[model samples]
Target: QKEVEQDPGPLSVPEGAIVSLNCTYSNSAFQYFMWYRQYSRKGPELLMYTYSSGNKEDGRFTAQVDKSSKYISLFIRDSQPSDSATYLCAILDYGGATNKLIFGTGTLLAVQP
Candidate 1:
């Protein structure tokens, strides 16, 4: 199994729609879960990071992690056209430094005006 997998969605939504993206991982040793947002060809910006199982909220974005199922989710509320971008889920190995991030194939989100 791949260490991490995502749908790579070209998910489209009207302005103000709620967006949910998810990923699953096979590595039980992953302890740090993160969500990143990237615009066009730019590098991803860290959106949220959580340790183990729990929920972390920031502005319009919320990240949830379920360690037992090896799943993670990112939810965007009140989405806007400016929110259109690729969202990537990442996990850090238990042995690595905080800087090491293993990413999933990103989900593309398009918020239409």
Candidate 2:
């Protein structure tokens, strides 16, 4: 039998609701991090964040970043089932001349209608 240490979640919430998702990192060497929304099990992209300690809002979404705490959060308002997917917390480390991006295990969310 394969060992399962941790399981990804299916965090279910109702449609038209508000939700907050948080992630924490232990690495201080990371240059920055971003929140990626993945759909249909496809690979997530880097068309996301540029971080600083504060809240950034656009439309129905808000991102909270705290460098000292190594914490970040994504808040969504007026959620929909169409938004169901895996959310990943990613950090890019530009060490030396090479750029390395690391990803969290990802948390799957399902917004129920």
Candidate 3:
């Protein structure tokens, strides 16, 4: 199975709607989880990071992790047109000497105004 899996969705929602993106992983060794947002033809910028199983919230973004189920989710409130972008879920494996990040197939989101 893939270390990390996410549905590469082109999800569309109206402005002010709530958006939820998710990912699943098979590796239990992953200790850090991160969510990144990327615009078309641009690099991704880190939005949130969580260590282990917990929930982290910042502004309109919230990241949740369930280590037992190996599932993670990112929730966005009051979604705006500017929130339209590709969301990537990544996990950091600390098993090796050099920690490496495995990214999921990003999900594209469009908030129509």
lDDT of 3 by residue, 9-107 (tens): 999999999999999999887889999999999999999999999999999999999999999999999999999999999998777497777899999
Q: Write the per-residue lDDT of candidate 1 for residues 1-113, one digit (tens) a residue.
A: 88999999799999999999999999888889998889987989988899999999989889999999999999999999999999999997656354577899999999999
The Cα local distance difference test for each model comes to 0.91, 0.73, 0.96
Best by TM-score: 3
Please write out the lDDT profile of model 2 over residues 66-104, one tens digit for every residue. 879777777889999887888877777666797866677
Clashes by residue pair, model 2? none
Q: Give the TM-score of candidate 2.
A: 0.83
Candidate 3 structure lDDT: 0.96
| Global local distance difference test of model 1 | 0.91
Give per-model TM-scores: 0.93, 0.83, 0.97
